[model samples]
Every structure is written in C-alpha cells, then in structure tokens.
Target: MLLQTIFYVAIAAEAMTAALAAGRRKMDWFGVCVLACVTALGGGTMRDTVLGHYPLTWVEDPYLLLICCAAALITIGLARFMEHLRWPFLLLDALGLVVFTILGCDVALEMGQSPIIVIVAGMITGIAGGIMRDVLCNDVPLVFSSELYATVSIVTGVIYFFGLQFGFPGEAVIIAAALIGFALRVAAIVWKLEMPKFVYDKELR
Candidate 1:
C-alpha cells in the first residue's frame, strides 16, 4: 500500500512539473502531453522493472497510467495559470522522494528482507530515475548535487528500519521516516546544507 501510494504521488508530481514547464516553453499541445506522461511514468517503470515486476505496475493497472495521462493533458491545457507556482513542483518532487524511499524500505522489510538490503533498495528506488533523468537531460543529478538528497533518503530508510526493529507500528514508521526525510530535504533547500566536499589526496597527485 505504501509503495503504491508513493508511486502514484510521484506520477502526479512529475506530470505537474512537465505540464508547467511545457507551458512556459510554449510547447505544442502534443509535445506537452507527451513530456508530462514521460516525466510521470518514467521513474516507477524503472522501479517495477528492477523489482522484477515483468508487466509493470502501470501495465497491470491501466487506470494508473490513465491518471497520469489525464493529469498531463489537463495541466498542459491549463499550464499558463500554473507558471508562477514552480515552487510547488519542487516541493512535490521532494515529497514524493521521501514517501517512496520510506515505502521502499518498509516494503522490503515486510517481505522478510535484510535491513541492509532494504536500505540499498529504498535509496535506489527513491533516486535512481532522477539520476537517470538528469543525465538524459544533461543536468546534474540530485544525487550529485550539494543538497544532501541521498543523505536524507538514506537516513529515512534507516529510521524506518530501526523503527520496525523497535516494535513501532509499521504505518507510524513509514510516516515518521517520510516526515524526517521531507523535513531534511526542505531544510537543505532552504538553508543550502550540503555534504562536505571531498578533499583531494596529495598522495594520488
């Protein structure tokens, strides 16, 4: 349930961003719609594939894809009105990352996986596509940015695992982890927090 919720939320967010960006760029109607759909569905498709879900979640449930498509189309048509709310797009993306990261770890734990593996999977599911998208778009990946994006996701997954180990309620664990990750992400964005830069090794030089 957690995973599904995160997937849908991500789709909605990406579609919104795509539509808004398309409108600002004055893209044609078809181009706008296609970009929105791609943004929305791209990440989750990779996730499902990595998880070994052959048909993929959107394929198994056409309505899910339809929701993304409809959201894209509607937003594209109304993009002009949304041009001023770009901050909402950033928030949505961060929110989705937090939720999805938490749920990824939680789902892994529920499936009787090891904590270490859960953490790794959760981080990958959370940011792998964003990394790919950034590369494809010739932009820096959030993973490589100074915003502590992966750190936040990593900590959230750790929190969820530890919460579960401590006998906390599963739903509470998921929510708390999501909140922590989101809070950290927002703080990093607002305050410009980042991981320390790596120092060059004089020996290697």
Candidate 2:
C-alpha cells in the first residue's frame, strides 16, 4: 500500500516537473498536459509495449492520466513558487527514478525475463520518459549528459534483483534499493560525478 502510494506521488512529481519544463517553452495548457503525460507515463508505456505487457498502465487505469493532468494544471497555478522548490523537485525526481526502475524490474521478473532484459527494462522505465520530454522540448536528454542518472537506475535494479535472489524479503530489498539509489543520485548531483565523455572532433563517413 505504501509503495503504491509513493508510486502515485512520484508520478505527480514527474508531471509537475514536466509542467515546469513546458512552461519554460511557453507551451499552452493542452501542450502542458500532453508533455506532463509523456514525462510521467511514457517510460512505462514503452517498457510495457516492448515487453508485450497488455493494457498499458494508463489504459487500464485511466485515472493515472487524470493525475498527470491535474499535477500539470496545479503546477501552472503554483508556477510563482516553483523556483524555490527546485531542490524538492530534484529529490522527488531522484526517488521517482529508483521507484520506477524497481517497478519495471518487478514487471519483467514476473514475466520471467532474463536478468539482462530485466535490468534494461528498469533503465528504460527510469530514464526514457525524460528523454522523450527533452526531445519534444528540443533539448538534450539529461540522462545522456547528466551525472549518474541511468547508472543509478541500472544499479538499483541490479541491487533489487540480486537481493531478492539471495532470499531477502521483498519489502526490505525495496527499501534498501531505494535508499542506496537515492543516496547515489544525491551524491552524484553534489559532486557532479559523471561517466566519461567521448569527444569526436572529426566527421566520419
């Protein structure tokens, strides 16, 4: 029950941040809602579609769409105070990333997917929505350039998977995974820790 509640809150947090991004681009109300939905739900939709999991999450639970839209609209109304809430949103986003990854891993595990595919699904669920949002907003996806984003997701999924394999209780594994993942993200942000970059100065055929 608590996990499900946090999942909903994370969805709203994602939508609110996406709403702020849409506001930066001067998008209309409808555009805001659209962007919010994409940012909040796009990752799960893609994960499910790729896995052939029927009844895409929002399709079966249409209220999730309403939640995203509501969050976006509320964000617009509270835009004035949002600047001060940047760190809060960042924290929520970090939590959302781990939570989404765990849930994605759960879905794949339930399907008896291979270990690698399970981890990949979690990574997709963690970062793909933000990628879509950035692309639609004409910006670089943060996961491609940011500090330890997808790494955090992959690590979290691996931790959860192996812990469960080692016979840890499900709830204990979740709490441990979420704490470690969230801490890693916060550390990355504070230290600007990042994967190495590859720079190609020449054009290749």
Best by lDDT: 2
Per-residue accuracy of model 2 over 1-205 as CA lDDT, tens digit each: 7778989999999999999999999999999999999999999999999999989999999999999999999999999999999899999999999999999999999999999999999999999999999999999899998799999999999999999999999999999999999999999998999999888899888
For TM-score, the strongest prediction is 2
Q: Which stretches of candidate 1 lie over 4 Å from their true place?
A: 1-7, 20-38, 198-205
C-alpha lDDT of candidate 1 relative to the true structure: 0.73
Model 1 per-residue lDDT at 38: 59
Task: Give the range of the ten consecutive residues with the poorest summed lDDT in model 2.
Answer: 1-10
Q: How well does each candidate superpose onto the true structure, as a TM-score?
A: 0.79, 0.98
Report backbone clashes per prediction.
0, 0
At residue 152, candidate 2 shows an lDDT of 97
lDDT of each: 0.73, 0.96
Please state every model's RMSD to the true fold in angstroms.
3.6, 0.9
Q: After superposition, how far is residue 125 of candidate 1 from its true place, in Å?
A: 2.0
